[model samples]
Target chain A: MSTGAVIEFTSISKRFGGVAAVKDLSFTVEPGRVTGFLGPNGAGKTTSLRILLGLVAASSGTATFGGVRYRDLPHPLKTVGAALEAASFHPGRTARDHLGVYAIAAGLPRTRVMEVLTLVGLAAHAAQRVGGYSLGMRQRLGLAYALLGDPGVLVLDEPINGLDPEGIRWIRGFLRDMAAEGRTVLVSSHLLSEVQQSVDDVVIIARGELVHLGPLSSLDTDAAPQTIVESPDREALAAALTAAGITFSIGRTGLLAATGDPALLGHLAFTAGVELSVLHRQKAGLEDSFLALVGGGHTL
Target chain B: MTMFLRSVSAEFAKIFTTRLWWILAIVLFGYIGLLAGGLAALFAGIQTGVISPDAVNTGGGPTDFGSLPPLIYSFASSVGYVFPVLLGALATTGEFRHQTLTPTFLATPRRGLVLGAKTVTLVLIGAGFGVVALAASVGIGGGVLSAFGVDALLQGAETWLLVARTLLAMGLWAAIGVGLGALVPNQVASIVIVLAFTQFVEPLLRLAASFLEVTAKIGNFLPGAASDALVGASVFTMASPAGTAPLDWWQGGLVLLGYALIATVIGYAVSWKRDVT
Candidate 1:
């Protein structure tokens, strides 16, 4: 893309007391794409988002927008639309008033409040007090507040949290559409699978470090040449493949080989008179990389 | 949308839309009614010969100082206005209660602007309470006096002057509360100390100060005494049971205003520089 909001973090580190919440963490969030900020709890995902928003100062390094820190931006709300935590509203304020304040702060017209309220499906309930709003409604309100000025870059921390199934689907579709419009969308969540299909590029962080940062397509294990052989005469088939200098292992049901293509493995199976029972190639789901990135303690 | 003005607007919105804010409003109005009733009864007993003519002649008469002046209006401003002061303080401190500070900071990144907004709104709320309390105090005090046959108490230009000064004094007391709100951002601590200072501490100090006239003179500079000079009566330097000091009205006003300014500035400093979220 020729243009979009480019968020770059260089050697960013933040420490609460002696414990390093995020230590020497650095990554570039690109433009016009959904960058998934995947991390487990206490993995500094929230902390890093805070630093980017300037809620917490970094011990070292910088997180810049275009090339400037968020605080340094001439108009922060117009430059970066951010939804950090959903419960940002004053409990007594109505949903409309809640967004009204932010819209005014962003120097946008007051009507923007109504527009955003409607955009987030909150128009009908705009008069309801935030104290009585459901968690799903609060999340929508948070998004409305963030989108008050329609900033180019959206930085959301666990925006899908507490959303119902329908809310989740709507959010995924909305985020995809926003990114499709050549806007940079950086959203973080504990559930990797939730964003697995939504995001174009993934940036997973574990224990305050970047574990992986690349496109999802690169993780297609199915495209990696794999071989399969099945036989009714399993014992004989295994021995014959070994004798033919084919490195294969006893798969869950059939036999798996590295050197033999599916067709070649089929021919070998026919020559041995072993009736083929099963043969298939496997693709790597996001689950494999997810568990590989975050362990059991934070997987939940 | 200057950062400063935006912050002030947000602060107003935050304080305006809370049950705690409305509770404070209720307490203010309710307290004003009580103080008016108390002042009325105190004046009535004096008029009905409960106190000797000696007390009446020295401007404590059933009708001599019978009118509720600006200073009296200060005392009567709001019985429960202190709650809003507590509310404003807690609003700032409550950011620490939940994880809400993170989102607030995201919305308005500059902490100083946010604090300034709070300061402005607190001052406004204090002023608002002051106005309501002043109106109620004057109206009820006058009604009580008239009902008890002391209608001629403020029979000249003095009565009108009392009304105007009472409004100004009410306004001043509101500012003083705002200052206190800023100086102490903790709800319980600030409310307790402010309420205690007004009721127990100031009254006690004035009583003790009158025992030593010089000390009473010094005590007259305290906020309660200063506001009393502007409203109705001050216990610190007057011959009342509260205490006796020789402080004139202007001196007391200056002292209270000084405290309000100092508290407000310090509150802004603490909130602006420190981490709010």
Candidate 2:
């Protein structure tokens, strides 16, 4: 297996007319892991990926693969395989012919076409024209195209957008396997839930700027732990919580205490002689933290 | 060199795998065949006294029997050039229409190299279209002329030279199509410009220009006129007044090349290197 290369974007900025699409965005994706380039819709995820692949010009800074610009890479296809959009195929050409064109252009052997088709589970449909492909199949074909050169790095944009549950599961495992083989995989998606299980590291952007970048577990750490408590007598429960100096707020279901341990809240209620009805700690889901960091509930 | 050749080979595969090229080829063949054959029959009949010249119009076609064969063959370039242009334009525009340029550029990052490969491939395919067109015009048109007992001039060296030049003209027309395609890049707009100009605009301009000596001098340099001049014969050119002569064949070829060069250069500067996403 070819070793993966580190991808870096340094102060990359792209402006379209008066609007800045990507503003001073900087991040690095290391090898031997899958990095989820996560953001809400129109967060410049696609624009940033395009710049990294040399499909778009950055107004400032550089996006390079292993310190070399994508355009200057001697064997670009073999070094960095990119699939920017799933629908970027000619409808009239068969899947085989579509891959065949790139294979010949990239100077790869014809046998690699079949190899990738089988790899992506599209071998049976290779002869069929792309016009007849479903959205899921097109996504698979796009992945097959990316794998055509067996490059060390893979860049995919919205790869799982239309995949079925099974395909999504398969791709998750496939991405892990690729990472296991030490290939740097950067997959972009607007939703954290879609890639939360698959990715090891997360690079979250919002409004054309980097909002968070760290390991997947680190996102949840930023979310403060809370416990939900309720009682048949809401007045006593609220008083007990306030008297104990525990910060609490009223929610539709109960009083939300700022503490994570349900035991502490239960003990406090017992001492205050408050008739408790509900008490449980709320697990801070990565999705919630992601939404909070991006500064909106609209993303949900 | 190897990279360029591989890119060229990939371009050829891109064209052949689709049905559009052959569909346009069939249309070109039939359109040119019917025109050349029909005109041959009418002109040959008038020449042989089988039909009255007054029946068709006020006057007759070229009374020079020696020029009839080349004139029929010239239809391959004169009328059939549109198909290659359309084919070339479609080939480039479709990349933008379908967003295939993303993958194409991914495979070959050098944008200029990709455009050059496309031009080279389209030129060759355009020459191939020229061959199919010539086959129709020569086969049917020559048969019609021979049936009227006129010398079809199939064996003459001059007739073959016209055929060779027609091939070159078709190839250049295809290059011009690529240039136009790169310049416009929008499929519908490029196609509209091609049809509107080839079918209506240039024809009207050429006709209006033919009446004035000063305008006629400039009109001779027009793409269609230059094409006819390069081919050495066109039914359209036969009607021009005596004083307005077509440019030398080589000069016409240079003028056609100049258009392709200008379009390609401007297009490369304006849009070809721009961001695709």
Each model's fnat? 0.37, 0.87
Per-residue lDDT over A11-111 for candidate 1, one digit per residue giving the tens place of the 0 to 100 score: 99987889888888888988789999988877889889878888777889899889988878777777788887777766777888777766655567888
Tell me how each candidate scores on DockQ against the true complex: 0.41, 0.86
What is the docking quality class of candidate 2?
Answer: high
CA RMSD per model (angstroms): 4.4, 2.0
Highest-scoring model, lDDT: 2
Tens digit of lDDT per residue, candidate 2, span B176-220?
999999899999999999999999999989998999999999999
Q: Quote the lDDT for A203 in model 1.
A: 80
Candidate models: Cα lDDT each: 0.70, 0.92
Question: In candidate 2, what are the lDDT values of residues A1-300, reduced to their tens digit?
Answer: 457999999999999999999999999999999999988888899999999999899999999999999999988889987877888989999999999999999999999999999999999999999999999999999999999989999999989999999999999999999999999999999888899889999999998999999999998873588899999998998898889899988898998899988998899889989899999998888888888888777563
Model 1: lDDT of residue B257: 68
TM-score of chain B of each: 0.75, 0.97
